[model samples]
Target: MNNPNALASQSFDLAAQQHPHLLRSASYNYPHRCAFKAVDDGDTQTVNQRLSISPLAIWLNLPARRFDTALGRDFLDSLIAEITLRKEAFGRRPVTQLLLRHPFLHYQGADITELMHLLASNFRLNHRDNSPIEYCAELLLEEAEGANLALLKGLGFNEFLLSLPASPSRGDYEKLHAIWQHAREFAADSLGVRLPYGYPEQDLHSMRALLDQILSLKPDRILLTPASELDRWNLQDHIHEHGSNSASQFALIYNALRHAGYRVLGNDCFVIGRDSLAIAQNQNRLRRTAIAYNSVNAADLLGLGPAASSQLGSRYESNLEAIQPYIENLQLHKLAIDKVLQLGTKAKACRVVADQLLCYHRLDIHYIENRYELALASLAENISWEFNAEANMELMRIHNGLLQLSDDGIMRLLFISDTFLAGLLKTPKKD
Candidate 1:
């Protein structure tokens, strides 16, 4: 199991089932598409996958959980240098961006404000001050203990996003207001925050309050559903006797955001007229792109530190969870990648189709069958299973090589993830 190659295989077969949410969220789909697992392992096959590929940029490391000025600067400089080298090696222009992952120490023993200050200094000193091309950075504020939206300016990241906690509450709505207020001040390019479920019919005010607050943020792009800790199926049966209560919840937020002038980009992500994503979608530029904001496209992420995950063109990999293994492997001049999944042609195509459905709730069956030689019949059948007796709905249809969901189903998108799995298995369960 320690063998990196074998671990990669196991990760695909084992971790994927257990960690379906990796694929559930439009943003987190990168790791799920690669191969998934929660273990200490590595992969060795297609070892040459790296040298043959071209990347937009090489990432710099994040500061430690607790900030150390010198180390963070060194990390930034090293990343910049690597970016230069990668650009040179590929014989491309000096147009490479740097990706910085949040160390996310939470409020346990660190202040995000200070971390922001440190990162801002590093960017000014290393990225913007010295570089000729407009060097940009994307901060995955996916995990942070507090919300000081002002801190983001110093970090110098063009794109900023977060995975809001799944437990939706009044305070959480207030937090969204603060985040949006700051996001507007800095024009925090696109924003994403999780919205948890379980709001009762009578407690509609809370849902309205939360959704309306998020609408007020007026973000250009929004990744709304980031995969809650609890799956819809796991909720009480009565809550979703009509299959799932997810659609109702999703509809609430969806309508509010739309009323506020936002339109759906794909499935779960939303964008207004001004955002670049909307521009691209208008120009017909959204073709096989990643769900991320500033990294090297979803497929080519370079996770530099422990707990970072990557999905390169042909390989899916992750770093060791412990710092020691990552450092030791680096010292030995070897890839610290402990988990890997060798992506084959069909899997890659399926990942794309899956992403399309997850994001847009539809797929080009014609394209898949014709291009990748994969069958949509199974996908179709799986979708059909969704509306079966268990879901308590007579909805869902597959026709003309396209997957379509009714207005009712759209509201239930949050809960359909399990249905997606059931459909994929070709056996829709009642539960």
Candidate 2:
């Protein structure tokens, strides 16, 4: 067999050179093309839009700046208003998961603990049904040390997710290990680690070493992300020139992890075989954003705080990333929506197919035929023919009434998804 790592590297370089967008599907926002718009408070139709589907998860993105009591309360009030509106519209199906991102950076000691309590209390009172909710917090490794873990656990934040540096020092690993032990003591339900690859210093060797260190602690799930061109996490001097070969390097790390018995799914997420993400993938219920979730049925996402985005049914809405505007709009009893995309029939179908291939690694022909009312047999035939060509690398194949992707195909999911999207776009819309 051809060396898997070599195949990944070759395919990755070609993807970068010719199919850059396809390679970019590895990023969280996969098929979404955001079109921003100014918020008009007078637009009642837009402002009054509510969640059409019961949200499975609620994401609270804390501002990077320190938290203020008055401002924080206003934010919470705005969140409550939004939830109330969704409940009124969709009826309370109850959100099963709540993820609070960058919480520790915003507050400390009693203040942070108090904020968590308030958030947990308000969310429970407003959104709870018979199902018990899972409360999760995503924060930096450094912040984990000083965070009031005991209080957070009491507030029902059972899951803790931390992002480590691209190149962690010995001290960093030690600190993480210490935090891991403490989290277990607090009865933390699950701990996930997000590790970024493609930094100037990271190669296959370095990444494997890093994986060894992290695996020793045995995080419930591991996410490997490409280092952003801009240092979003404030990693200081570790930020350097990110080369164009980062994707190729990421592919190498991915192949290495797979050979080591790690179940690396989608593009960059690695987990044990029994991890929820893996199970969700097998069950064909994995949904993706910045995080992955199991959506047994249709699932919506409600995002709060500055710069957040929500996927509510066929519509995608984003809040103003600017703190002042987000705060002022909410203060005026307005949803701080800065952009909206109402998915058309074609776009929605494209997303469904893309999600199936990217997350589940297979596309059910009958499922698409039944759901979209579009004949994909012709599309499948075309894909098979073209994929058989040398240039296309045969990344995908047709099995018994199913179109399944090889690992290489998953790496180029956006490309394959785009191909299907092109076919959908060509089809005449039903009158």
Candidate 3:
């Protein structure tokens, strides 16, 4: 196979030349491979001796069908033993110091320790880090929540909310109030003392009262959760019965909050009319607030669990799924990898592009060009795509709201969907 580093080098070169400003200190070069020297027969093999070599190197040199065969599993197990002994040493080297030198290597090593153990055991890595035994469990939990939010933003819900914030114009509120009163009188007589199941007469009265209260509060933001039985029914069904009453309610509430100068945040999924509430900010205030929903997209995600998975670039591998196998393998100084998959480069590129688009919305054409050059130089270019100037225009049109072309003719990200953002990794996804 062609060298991955060479390809990466070529891409990096292109990106560096075009967007030197963006990649001030980014490494465009890949690490070089070195030959291993045989140890003297007279010398004893100690933990320090094992730490001298790269665990990745040991795993790569294994001949078990390259992560698919029994031999590969054994190789992985051995690698884990070496890593466990060296973990403390590894941690002793402050990450802050490393970041000062190589700011782009953002992941923490502790996150991948458990996966190292699991890989030594010849089991499939689950890639889920929710277990108590998992190292860096807290970090993984935060990553999971961020991932979920990214998914939500990707579904275009953010854009929907952006539009809904303007629905409650003062004129519209007055109209809604009149309509509500009229509906209340009609319902009072039509039911003749029996109210609707979900929409009882009292509920309408309550809704009206709530509206009044909201007007009085004049909050800068209002969050509402429909605690009534109407919430259980479909939105379409509610709209049919209420003749845009729900829509008006949303609009009125939103506009009321806006007039009151509060920012509103909520969704159709909200219950109890309001659960968690907060003040809203204007565009200028929001830009300064630095309030971002959880989102992360990184090239790899390494998880550590009895059975954890490590997603390297596009490839995914899992270790033994149970604690017993993992611990036993670790005791034996073995790797637990039980499953491995190689993904297509297109898929990998798509993930990368999706993440980039979601975060910044604009593709840096010059950056892509330089990256292509660097990939070529490094011989790590595993994927092929037409990333010329024209491609940038096409991508912009596809993800309209998320990206914008800068004055320099490079793509600049505009508004990334929370879904895509969540997928981006702020830390290493492993452990």
Identify the leading candidate in terms of TM-score: 2
Name the weakest run of 10 consecutive residues (lDDT summed) in model 3.
95-104
**RMSD, every candidate, angstroms:** 9.3, 6.6, 20.9
Computed on alpha carbons, the lDDT of every model, listed in order, comes to 0.47, 0.63, 0.29
TM-score of each: 0.60, 0.79, 0.27
- Summarize candidate 2's per-residue lDDT along 47-71 as a digit string, tens digits: 4433333445677777644535435
Which TM-score value belongs to model 2? 0.79
Q: For model 1, how does the per-residue alpha-carbon lDDT over 90-162 read when each residue is reduced to its tens digit?
A: 3231223445445343231234345434434332233355442112333323343234344444544555555
For model 3 the local lDDT of residue 274 reads 22
lDDT (C-alpha) at residue 323 in model 1: 54
Give the per-residue lDDT digits (tens) of candidate 3, residues 190-223.
Answer: 1000011223222334555555633542222222
Worst 10 residues of 1 by lDDT: 422-431
